[model samples]
Target: MDSSPHKLYHVHGFDSRQFLEHYFSDKSDMAFGDDVLKFPIEKLRQVFAVGHINGDILIDLSIGSLIHHLYSASEFFKNIIVLKANNRCIMELKRWVDERTGAFYWGHTSTLLQEKEENSDQCQDQEAKVRSAIQHVVKYDLEKENMTDPLVLPPADCVISVWLLEVISKDQDDYIRYLRKISRLLKPGGHLMMIGALDITYYLVGKDKFQGFTYDENFVRKVLAGEGFIIDYCNVKERTAVSDLTDYKATIFIAAHKEK
Candidate 1:
C-alpha cells in the first residue's frame, strides 16, 4: 500500500486539465469520445431517475477529482458532501467549486447533462446548481475505521462512490474492507451507487501510473451483498478499441440499497 501522504490513490500530482482533456473533451488526441464518458453519466442518470433516490443528504465518496457524476445528483439531494482522499484532489475540486482562476472548465459536461436531462442545452444554470448544492468538501481516509473521522456526520441517505474502490484498494480483501467501512456511513436501507473499472490493474494520469484492483461484475455483486446491500441495478460497458489510455476491459456501474 502506498501510504505516503502526498501519493494517495488519486493525488499524485494529478493534472486536472490533462485529465479533462484526455477523457471528457473533444480533443483530437483523445482516443475515445462521448461513447466512454457518457456511459457512467447516463447510467447514473437512470439510477437517480427511478424516483427513490431523492433525500436530505447525499455523500459523494468519490476521489474528488471528477465532478461529472454530480450534475444529476445535485438536483435531487438537498445537501451534498464531497469526500476526498488527499489534499491535492481536494484543492483541485475546490478551485472549480469556488470558480477560481485556472479552474478546469466543466461547462461541457454540464451542458451535456442538461441537454440529456431537461432536453435543453443551457449550461451556467446547471453548473450553478451543483456549486450551490455542495455543502462540504472534506478529506477522507479509506484505511481508517471511520472514513470521515473526527467529524461526526449523520448517516447519509444516499452515497455515491464512482471509480473509487478499484483504484484505491490494493486487493480483493482490501476492497471488501473498504466497502464495508464506507457503507457504514449510510443509514439502513439507504442507497449506494458505485462505478468501477473491470478486469484492470492500472491506469494512467498525465505521466503517472496508478494501481487498480482487478475484478469483474461477479465480484462486485458478491461484495455488495456480503456487506448487507441488495443489488438493484448493475450494468457494464465493454471498452472500445479506440483507447489504449488504460488497461481496463470494461466499466461497471451498480446501484444497491442497504438491507435493514
Candidate 2:
C-alpha cells in the first residue's frame, strides 16, 4: 500500500471493489459505517426531506462509487450529474448504475434509507430511483481550470459533495481552489451541501492509506462564507464507533447557498 491514498486513487489506482467492500459491505468497518455512513445518511434525509433545497438539477462530486446518499436526492431533483476525478471510480459508478454483474452491493445503504423513511419494502426501489435520476457519470480532473472542460455541463441548481474535497486537497489552499471549481458549477444562488470529517488526517481504503486535510467546523463555515455562500443549516455529530481505519473526531454536514 502506498503512503498516500491519493496516489493510489488518482495516480496508480487501487481496486475499486476493495474500496467498496472495505466500507460499504454489510459487515464493513464499524467506524466508517457509523460516522461516515449512518451519520451522513441521516443528515441527508433530514436536509433533503425539508423543502429548503428544491432544485431541478443536482451535481454530485464525491469520492469512490457510492450513491447511497443520492437516494434522498432522487426524491427532489429531476436530473443528477455525477463528476469523478478518476476513470476507475467513474467506471465503478457506471457498473452499479447499469446493474452489471460484479457491481458492489448497496443493499445495506438501501436498507438504511428504508429504515429512515419507515418503508421497509422500498429498498429495491431506492436503487432504481438513483439509477433513473443519474443523468450522467463524467470523469474530471480538479487540477484543470475547467474540471470538465470541453464537456461543459449546465450549471447545477445544487451540488452535493461528501467525503471528497478533504481527501483530494493537499492543504488549505488546495481546498479553496477545489471549492472554487466546485462553486463554479453552481448557478448564482445555487446550493452546496458538503460533508466531511473534523480533524481527520488519513483514512484507509482497502490496504491503501489516503491523507486528508484536517480542519474544524469553524473553517468549514469560514471557507463557505469566503466563497460567497450563506449558511442555511449545519449539523455536527460526534463519533460513536471505534475503528483504526480512520481517526475522525466528528462528522459535519453543512448546507449553504451561493449569494445571488
Candidate 3:
C-alpha cells in the first residue's frame, strides 16, 4: 500500500510517533502483564475457551482497541464489525478490516454526508469536512436521548465496544442510552467486551479537537449494569502516554459480557 499523507493515519498538529508509542506501549505492557492475566483476560479466556466466539458475529465500536484485541485473541471470531462515528477513523477502519478476514466497517453518517459523493478523492474530502465539522459544532441530531432509530448493523453473534459510551455524552443518562444502543445490537446470550478509559480528560485525534469524558469504576459499572450487562471482569490499570507534548495518565481497561 502507498504510504502517502492521505493514505496514512495522519496526526494533525501533533507528533504521531509519540502518540502511537505512548498509547500502544501502555496497551502492550498491560496486555502482556500479570495484572490482566488475573482479571479480564483470564475470565474471558475461561468463557471463550468453551468456543463461544468461534464462527460468531462480533462487533467492536471505536475500532482502536478492537484492532489490538483482535491481534491478541487466542481464538478467532468468524465475523467482526468495527464502528466509528468519525469519518477519518472509519476510513482507516475500512482499510484495517479489509486486511482481516470476516470483518466489516460501519460509519455513522448522520453528521457528515450532505448526500454521498461517488469519487474516492471526494470521499477523503468528506472525511476532512467531518473532522472540521465536529470541532466547532459539538451538538448533533444523533445524540443520546434523541437516538430513536434502531442501529442498523449486520447481524452478529456478539458485540464489543471500548471507550465509546462516556465520550459520546457527558450526561449520565445519555451515557446509559449509548450503552443501550450498543446492547440492542447483540443477540441474547452473545458476548460483549468493553475496554474503558476511566476518568480522563480532553485528548486530540490526529489534528482534530475532541471533548473527552472521565469515568470511574463505579460510573462505568452503573452504565453497564443499567444496559443489562454483567461485569464478567474488570481491571483498573494506569497508562502513561505522551499526547500533545505532555504525558497523559488515566485508568484504562474494562471487559464485560451480556447477561444471559
Leading candidate by lDDT: 2
**Residue lDDT tens for model 3, 16-84:** 333343333344342322322222344344455555465445666642322434422324464455555
- Per-residue lDDT of model 2, residues 1-260, tens digit only: 65654553455555777887776678734446876667777888898878878788999998888898888888889999998878888899999999999888888888777778766675559889999999999888777788887799998999999888788778899889889999999999999999988888877877678777889999989999999999999988888767777787888999999999
| TM-score of every candidate | 0.90, 0.93, 0.59
How does model 3 score by TM-score? 0.59
Q: Which 10 successive residues of model 3 have the least lDDT summed?
A: 132-141
Rate residue 17 of model 3 by lDDT: 34
Give the TM-score ranking, best first: 2, 1, 3
Candidate 1's C-alpha lDDT? 0.78
Alpha-carbon error at 21 in model 1, in Å? Answer: 3.5
What tens digits encode model 1's per-residue C-alpha lDDT throughout 15-108? Answer: 6566567766655676644545677678888888778888899999875477888877887998999998777777888998999998877776
The residue-level lDDT of candidate 3 at 97 comes to 38
Q: Which portions of model 1 show Cα errors greater than 4 Å? A: 1-13, 118-124
Q: Rate the local accuracy (lDDT) of all candidates.
A: 0.78, 0.83, 0.47
- In model 3, the clashing pairs are 12-206, 12-207, 57-157, 199-215
- Give the number of the best model, judged by TM-score: 2
Worst 10 residues of 2 by lDDT: 4-13
Roughly what TM-score does model 2 have, to 2 decimal places?
Answer: 0.93
